[model samples]
Target: MSKKMGLGKGLQALIPSYEDENKKTLRNITVADIKPNPKQPRQEMDKQKLQELADSIKEHGVVQPIVVREVPDGGYQLIAGERRWRACQLVNMDTIPAVVTEYTNIQAAEVALIENLQRENLNPLEEAVAYQSLINEFGLTQEELSKRVGKSRSYVANMLRLLALPDDVLALLSSGQISNGHARALLALDTDEKKIVAANEIIKKQLSVRETEKLVKELLQNKENRKKKNERAPEMEDLKDQLQGVFGTKVQIKTNSKGTGKLEIEFYNDDDLSRILEILLDDNSHVSRETN
Candidate 1:
């Protein structure tokens, strides 16, 4: 077994020699020359974020050189510092700061995955993907991956399972279109179509994570009922719309299983209440309405 290095030794491993404090090696590395590892688990990168990193690099040149290993194929392979390389490209720089060495495929992959995990800024999806890569490509067990990243085995396992979600759902997750809680809730549905539909409803209704979970449970129980029920529920929604249109304000209606429901009419203050009462009275309906 290769003994793990301490922090100082690890830093030295990446930056082998520290000469003059002011004199750093900054030369002869093109963005195109640095190839991303095929085994890299993080398949998605946020473009907007890359632009932001690039902007920062423009203001301050890359403070850190990416660690790389020269491939037998006559080019360099990225071991760590993909974000830095991306930032450099944003500035359209011909050369970047990098530390080049020779490493086996396993060593390069392990280094890259470990480096990204140590950096705290990675989003949950990125963390999950990296964890999956370690398991799939490097033959690391969940317990081993957990130890390497300072996470529990369950944490590692749960995150890895997130990748099994549908592509659209994963895209929503990566883009921050939905919360982890929301994604987890949607994952309960068995079909991709169900998951997608639930995802849409969660976004459209601004549903809370708990609410989404309950909604999923209810839908799963009534999966057959859902098909017979109106997909859009135009009739039910139209009632709220018409009420709001007539009231010239927001209206809320909630229904129960028996088709009995309550309507809550909203008002800003005494003035608004008075207007509503006046309209009700002027309508001259046969049924009398009570008010406080």
Candidate 2:
């Protein structure tokens, strides 16, 4: 499905149904009475952005009501809209508009994550961890999670893979020193050392995603070449030995997959060179005589 359409599906799933008047009623709840959701996906709020939001709340007031659920202590636990709740607190408003709902812990977590996702509030690492928590805590599969979050399965899978990155690399990603594309490209490498090196180069050189990908490809290709060189066949080794014996010197043979190769016979001095040349001339004369 198109991302736009899937996002709508996800939003609908996250939004609570308020068909009944009891569920739909907006109540003025005391700001101090509401506790933040422990499962809220967002870890850090942008202070500058929050200050701007608080200023806007002062001028315009909250346009949308925060969603909350009642706790045993007769207080409300914020299910969604923590940003608005925070803004209300910033302005020291006594009571804020809230929609009371009944939700289990899992439902509350889902609601909070989806709300932040819809608003694009959580960083990539935070988003991945939130998704992982739901999977581990609630046993949601990637497919199920994608449906719940209104994203493609690949998108969810790729996000989860980011967690495998080293802490330093993840820090780079979190701090915006490198983009997600750069991180993903680094995953092509098998070792953390290589990944860290590549990441540093990317930041220092200001490399683009495509450039990083190319660099990774070249590194992998060079690695494979070394592996192939180290794994030469016994037959090739035997051939090299025979050539060395025939030439009275060292010889080397290099071949590629297409049955194409190069052969080099080494000589240490003018005498050695003349000996090799005479050997080649004798072979040529023998071939010519055989053909005649």
Candidate 3:
């Protein structure tokens, strides 16, 4: 591991010792010569945000030096601060201040992922993808990944689960239509259909996390009710069918564990309701006459 370096200490830990002390000092490097890290996990940058950064760079100059490593052919490969490099380009700066660092490809990826995450720049889906890459490519366990990223193990695990979401839900997450909390709530639903339905509802209603949780719970409860209804005895189903035939409408019988239950009959109009009432009243009158 990288010595459990925290946010501020990360850059110092990644900086390499230069044989010539002057080489370690920050210096202006040609913006055109610095190439972006191919392994960089962040796929998108907000152009407006970059423009704001560029405006700042134009006004104050590049305050923080970007980190880069010397490439084999010539120039350099950016290890960190890609946003600043881009902003410098936007401001038409020929050269930007940078620190030269030496790191393996995996180390560079780790540093880039850490920087983006610490800044809360990457969306949930992007964060999850980045974490998965490190786990798959570098064989880092969830615990190790958590420690390296300065996040809880459960947080890492939860973030990884976002990747398993349906593409539609992932799209919502990527596009900022839904939040991480909303996505997490959607995970409670068992099927993709239900999840997509819930996701759409969330976006349409602009639901809060708690509201989304409540909605998922209702959906799961209805699902469980249907499953339980399907598991009922054949005799109960037959009874329901017989009742429906007598009532000339749909009938549902729901029972509890103790055998307590209610019978529900569906009637579409007043005439239909009157017909059902007549049957019940006639049956009651017949029973009363027999008792007399």
Highest TM-score against the true fold, candidate: 2
**Residue lDDT tens for model 2, 1-292:** 2122233266555555556554555789999999988888888888999989999999999898889999998899998999899998999989998878777777778778888888888888889989999999999899988887778899999999999999999998887799889989998899999999999999999999999999999989888876776666765777677667777788888787545888888888999899999988784533211111
- For model 1, the stretches where C-alpha displacement exceeds 4 angstroms are 5-32, 101-103, 118-123, 220-292
What does each candidate score in C-alpha RMSD? Answer: 13.7, 5.6, 6.6
lDDT for every model? 0.74, 0.83, 0.84
Poorly placed runs, candidate 3 (over 4 Å): 1-13, 16-25, 238-292
TM-score of model 2 vs. true structure: 0.83
Across 178-278, the per-residue lDDT of candidate 1 in tens digits comes to 88788888878899999988898988999999999999999887865565355536666776787677677888877654456688989999999998778
TM-score of each: 0.61, 0.83, 0.79
Q: Rank the candidates by TM-score, best first.
A: 2, 3, 1
Q: Is candidate 1 or candidate 3 better by lDDT?
A: 3
| Count of clashing residue pairs in every prediction | 0, 0, 0
Clashes of 2: 0
How big is the positional error of residue 228 in model 2, measured in Å on the Cα after superposition?
1.2
TM for candidate 3 is 0.79
